[model samples]
Target chain A: MRRLRHYARLLAVQMRTSLTLAVQYRFDFFLEGALALFWLAITLIPLLVVYSRRESVAGWSFPEALVVVGWFSVLKSVLDGGVTPSLNFVVEGVRKGTLDFVLLKPADAQFLVSTARFEPWRILDFLGSIAVLVYAFHRLGHAPRAGDLMVGLALFGVALILLYSLWILVVSVSFRVVKVDNLSYLFISIFDAGRWPIDVFKGALRLIFTVVFPLALMTTYPAQALLGKLTSAHALLAGTGGLAFAAIARFVWKRALRAYTSASS
Target chain B: MIRARKLCKTYRVHRRPPGLLEALRSVVRRRYEEVRALCDVSFDIAPGERVGFLGPNGAGKTTALKILSGLLYPTSGSVTVGDFVPQDRRTEFLHMITLVMGQKQQLLWDLPPAETFAMNRALFDLPRDEADATQKELVDLLEIGPLIGKPTRQLSLGERMKCELVAALLHRPRVLFLDEPTIGLDVSMQARVRDFIRRYNESTGATVLLTSHYMEDVAALCPRVIVIDKGHLVYDGDLRTLARRIRPEKRITMHFSSLPAPGELDRLGNCVARSELQATLAVPAAQVTEAVRAALGRLPISDISVEDPPLEEIMQEFLGGQPANGGVRSA
Candidate 1:
């Protein structure tokens, strides 16, 4: 608990610093928020056109698909706004040998890297995404069961942990492949597949998405929880995937650090 | 306290020459080479001791420092810093040490240095009051009162460097690993930084292990130095001993009011250079005083001073210009 509090303080201070920096470029901050709204509209329009042709695709109604889309936006914004910035700090630090400074600090190295940078504007997108998520539920004309709501929130946490573990593995690999700085872009591209429900894919592709990449675990299953379509068995499977990825991240991180011969002057 | 026993760090690096063909080929078939950064490096540093790790670039000075600071795990060997295994990077170990690399700025680039300091204070888990007091003391000592408020990107290199020191020290670390902390600073700024480091070490009793290419940095700050060449420890002892052992000639330079006859000064010492206003002679260490007295009696000299050959020359001789795979002495 003491360790937890220490990290909380550390993250708070870092976010405060990021906030101050964001304020200095207020125009850019608002501009990006506007762009996020624009992106949401642009994304929904194409899907709206597709829904006009078919009553349902992959067993998801248009409004139900909207929930998945809204969840996608929320996760993407959160990762882009908070985690990606900090992930960049880790990658850049390793490439430039600035990670040495981080290692010397009294805090946990992973904690330091993950909390070093925050994008205040990204929070704007997160808020916007949450609004869309609420609107989608409202359009469906059904309130979620209390139990389903609780499970949805729990799965949300698990999804976030799983994705963060994947991110850690990416950055950990970057310590060795210093020249590959665009791994984040690669991650974002892969994440694009998660916008659609895994049910849309078939055969080998569905298995790959659900189990290997786990894009379905990031958004679809949680959205299913709210729609009352989720099962305890599936939730357990997602939770297990999260735990497995968490372990993999830890192992990869240790191995990568051991392999790290910090960049020469 | 710091200790290293036969510390070795080896890296498996991808090798490729610069060319479109090589780049294209590397995409499919890249070659890996084993580069030994440090070989059997060992050293012990007591509390409050300031030691310089001296070598040319790629001589493993940084690799050693990185291992000591726990940023990298050695391929072999062991190191304990403040009684904590550095490679373990336990919170207690990190709390007791700070590494400042001049080439890299840890401060949030777009934010004010004050923010970084505040974050560091929290990360180090200092009480709010104690953190504030430490920040005030360090900012005042570095005389960077105004710079902390401005964005770090706007600050000049020297200003940023001074600010960097404040960020690194908010934790009041007992051990400091400084890698080229004065790199790229002007002569005066370098001197100021060197002075600040000395004072910090004296006041806090922080054990400092520093590496720099600048000879003045070592001469002014570290009385002892460990010289490495191609992953080998060349010399590890008093700075004066290394200098004297590598290059024994003491330089005696005299400034004369008028041109002295050229041959008249040669008898006193071997004339390294002679000019109308000044003349430099390389005299044996045992005969520096005698040479100076002889020059004073022979010519109406305005000023006469005796000093060791500049450290750059000594290193040049010691490393043989390019560091080679060779033997070394340890004390």
Candidate 2:
């Protein structure tokens, strides 16, 4: 319980630092807010184009696909606001040797580095995603049942863990290959595929999305849970898979730290 | 509080010639060379001792400090700070030590340093009151009260370093690994930092192992120093004893009431520097008293004083004479 409290306090302090930094440049805050809306609008275009000719693509209807896009936007916001900034700080820290400070602290170095920074303005991206999810559900003419909502929220948690674990794997590679900014760009591009429902991907791509990169687990499963179409068994699999990814990420992170020859001071 | 035995750190560096064809060819196959950063280096420091690590650039001083602080693991051998092995980096072990590198900073660039202090308080899990008190004490000591409120980017290099010191020390580390803590600072700023370090050690009984390119920093703050050259530990002992061993001559300066005769100054000792009103001589340690007496008696002298030769000269001569494989000696 004390350890939990300690971590909670650490997270709070990190968030406060991010907030302070976010407000420091008022112009940046406003500009990023505008960009968030712009990106949300851009995200909806392909969905509109595909839905215009056909009533449905694969098995998912337009509103159902919108649900996937909503989740994708939500994850993107978390990636941008919570994960990318912190991990980018880690990469820069590793290059500059400032990661020494993170390592020297008594707390868990991974936790510290993973929460080193945040783009609080990305909360605008998150709110925009909520609006998308709301409009999609409204278009469908019914809200999810409470039980489905609970499952959806739980799956959302699993999705976030998986998303963060994937990023951690990317960051772990950075310890060995110091310059991995392009690797992160590749990751963002791959994540763009998550905007479509899992059914739209078939054969080898479906298998890859389901198991290898797990974009389906990150977006499709939670959307399915909200639509009351997912099974308890699939939910169990998602939970276990998220935990497994986290475990692997932790192992890789530890091994990478052992390999770390901090950049020369 | 700190012990390193036969610490050896080797780095596998990817090497390639500088050419586009070579780069493209190297993509298919790469060459790697093992560079020894530290080899068979050993040292120990008792609690509350201020030991300076002195060496030229790329002399493995920083490498040794990094191993001790647990930022890097030695390729071979063992190191411990306090009761714990550093590479293990146990929470308890990490809580007990801080490494401050002058070339890098831990401060949040866009936020005030007070925010970092708060963040550290949470990260180190210090009680709120205790952390606040420690921050207050350090801020006052560094005289950075007004500056801490400003964004770190707005602060000068010296100011930022002062804040860095406060951040590193706020956890009240038992051992400090300071690498060039006063680097790139003006002379006065350097002296102030050195003074702060000495006082902090005195007050807290913290063990300090510092590496600095500045000889004066080592001279003023460290009673004992470990000198390394070419990845070899050449000497480890009292700073003064090392100085005396390397350059035994004492420097004597005299201000003349009247101009000394042309060769009168040279007769006392080796005249290293001379001007119209004053002259400086390097006299052997054994003959310093005799030389002083001779100068006073034979030459028109207003004032004269004897002091050891400057540390820079001693270090230059010391490192200059050391072979790559010079054996280590401790006084």
Candidate 3:
């Protein structure tokens, strides 16, 4: 518990510093906001076109699909806002030997690396996603029950854990591989597949996302919970998958740290 | 309170030639070469002792320091610092020690140094007043009071390094591992850092293990020195003793009132350098007095001084004489 408090305090420091840094570069924030909105529009344009042609695809209605896309947007915003910047820190830390300083600290290395930065401007995407979610709810003309809201929040938390775990797993490869310029691109490409419903994928590809890659848990399961379509077993499965991915991430991080010879020597 | 028995750290590095075909081939069949970073290195540091870890580049000095500070795990060995194994990196152990690398910094680059200090205060769970007091003391010592407010990237390297010291030392750890702490600093800045480190050690009674390519830093701060070359320990003990052991000749330099004949100076000792009216001779420690007298009597000497050979030369000779695989000294 004390360790948790220490990590929390360190994370708070990171958040505060990142906020100040973002504020200093206000122009960059505006640029990032514009970019994020443009990307969101690009993602939604196809959905709008598809819905115009067909009422629904893969059992999900057009408005319901908007909720899925919005929820994904929110999750992606959180990730781009926090984990992306932190991964950059990891990459630079590895290159410059600053990770040695982190390893020397008394705190857990994983916590330090994960919560080391935040990009406040990326929250624009979250706001945009919330706006879409509200509009989609109004168009559907249905209010989620109290139980559904609770399940949605819980599933959202699970999705966050899964996303964070996958990111750490990807970035931790920097310990063994010095050059990680393309690693994040590869990760985002895999994640882009999650923008659609997992059911749309079939056979080995579906199995890959569902069981092996696990991007399905990051988007589809959470959106399913929020739309009141997730069964108790599915919720349990998502939670279990989150826990397993987190454990694997921790294991991989430990192994990577052990393998870290540092850049100086 | 630091001890290591046969501590060894080796790294397996992937090797590939620089070519498109080699890059493709490496993707298919990657080859690795094992480099011994630290081989059977063993040393004991008593509480409050400040020892200079000395070596040429890639001499295992930084490697040993990294292992002792828990930054890297040793491949095989028994190592303990203040009753905790370093590789375990226990909280108490980490809290008790600090490592400062001049090439790398712990400060948040985009934030002010004061922010990092505050962050460390919370991370270390230091009492507010105590942490503040330590910070103030270090800030005053480093004379970085005003510089702390500026973003780290905006500060000069020396200023940033001073702030880095404050961040690392705010917890008042009992053990400090400093690698090239004075590197890239101006002469005066280096001297200031050396003085600050000495004063900190004196005040806190902290044990310091320092590695630096700058011999002046070692000469100023450390009484005992450990010399390593190519992952092996070649010499260990008193700095003066090591210098005398390796380079027994004292350098005698004289400024003559008039030009002296070459053979006249050669009679005094082995002429190391000679100019129109000045000459320098390398005389064995036992013969330094006789050599000086002979030069004074035979030559029109206006001024003369005798001193031990430069530390750099002593180190070069020490490293050059070491046998291959003369692995790190074991206690």
Candidate 4:
């Protein structure tokens, strides 16, 4: 119980530090706000162009696919605001040997590095994504059932775990390679595909998105849960899959730490 | 509180030649070379001991400190700190130790140092009152009370280092592994840091293992030192004893009221430095009394003093004369 309190306080302090940093330069807050709105517009343009060509690309209608794009925007906010900044700190830390301070702390080094930085202004993007979700539901002429909302929330958590785990796996590679900016760019490029519904892709691409990289689990499955189109069995599989990815990421992270030869002082 | 038994660390470094053609050709296959950073070196430090780790560049001093602080594992052998294996990095072990590297900083670059201190308090799980008191004490000791509220990016290098020390010590760990803690600081700042470290050690009874490029830092703070050369443990003992053993001669410096007669300065001892106003001579330890007597009688001296050779020269001769595989010595 005491350890739990310690970790909670630790998270709060880390967030506060990041918040203090975020507020230090007032111009950055406004700049980030502008960029967030610009990216949201850019994200919707492709969906608009695709839906304009026909009534639907796959089984998903224009409004239904908007739900997937909503979830994508939400996930992107979490990734950009929380995950990517911290993981990028790790990469820079590895190259500069500043990760020594993280390792010397009494807390788990993984947790410490993962919570090192954040961009609080991403809350604007998050609110915009929620507006998109609400508009999609309004266009459907019905509110989601309470049960569907519960499942959707749970699956949203699962999606976050999957996304964070994949990033962790990418960061673990930094211990050996030391410079992984291109690899990180590659991951970001792949993430761009998550903005589309999973069914739009055929055959091997679908299989890869569903299992290997798990973009389907990250965006499409959660959107399906919200629309009341997902079954319990699929939800169960998503839960188990999320846990498995987390387990694999945890294992790789530990092994990579053991193999870490800190950049020479 | 610290024990290392035949600790060895080796790294397999990737090797690549220069030129775009060589880089393209190396894409097909790469070469690696095993570089031994530490080799069968061992030492035990008692609690509250301030020990200097002396070595030239690439002499494995930082590697040894890293291993002791649990940042790196040895390729072979074992180390225990405060009754726990360092490599295991258990909560208790980490809670009892802290490592600071001068070239790198742990403070948040965009935030004030107070935020970093608060973050450490949470990370170390310290009691609120206790942490506050410790922070207050350290801030006063380092005279950084005014600087902590400013953003770290705005602070000068010396001020940032002082704040870094406060953050590292806020946990009040039992062991400290400091690597070049005063690098790039001006002479006054260096002396202030040294003074703070000595007082901290004396007050807290913590074991400190320090490595620095400045011999004056070592001489002022560490009575005992461990010397490594080419990844070999060359000497470990009292600082004065090591200097005496390495260069067993006294340096006599005399200020002249008038120029000495030709060959007069050489008659007393081997002349080392001679200028128009002053000359220094190296005298054998056994004949120091006779040389001084002869100098006093032979030369017109305005001032005279005798001292051991400078620590820098002693270190140069010690490391320069050591064989590649020199045996370890401890006293």
Clashing residue pairs in candidate 1 (N, C-alpha, C atoms within 3 angstroms): none
Top candidate by lDDT: 4
How much is A64 displaced in model 2, in angstroms? 1.5
Candidate 3, residue B105: the lDDT equals 84
lDDT of each: 0.85, 0.89, 0.84, 0.90
- Provide the DockQ value for model 1: 0.75
- Please compute DockQ, using alpha carbons, for every candidate against the native two-chain complex: 0.75, 0.84, 0.70, 0.85
Distance from true location, Cα of B215 in model 3, Å: 1.1
TM-score between candidate 2 and the true structure: 0.95
Best by DockQ: 4
Interface RMSD for each of the candidates: 1.4, 0.8, 1.6, 0.9
lDDT of 4 by residue, B73-176 (tens): 89998999999988888999998988888999999898889989998999999999999999999999998998999989999999999999999999998898
Candidate 3 residue spans exceeding 4 A from truth: A1-4, B18-20, B321-331
Q: What range of 10 consecutive residues in model 4 chain A has the weakest lDDT sum? A: A256-265
TM-score of each: 0.94, 0.95, 0.95, 0.97
By TM-score, how accurate is candidate 4? 0.97
Which candidate gets the maximum TM-score versus the true structure?
4
- TM-score, chain A, per candidate? 0.95, 0.98, 0.95, 0.98
On residues B150-238, what C-alpha lDDT tens digit does candidate 1 reach at each position? 98999999999999999888888999999889888888898899999999999988998898767788888999999887888878899
Evaluate model 3 with DockQ and give the value: 0.70
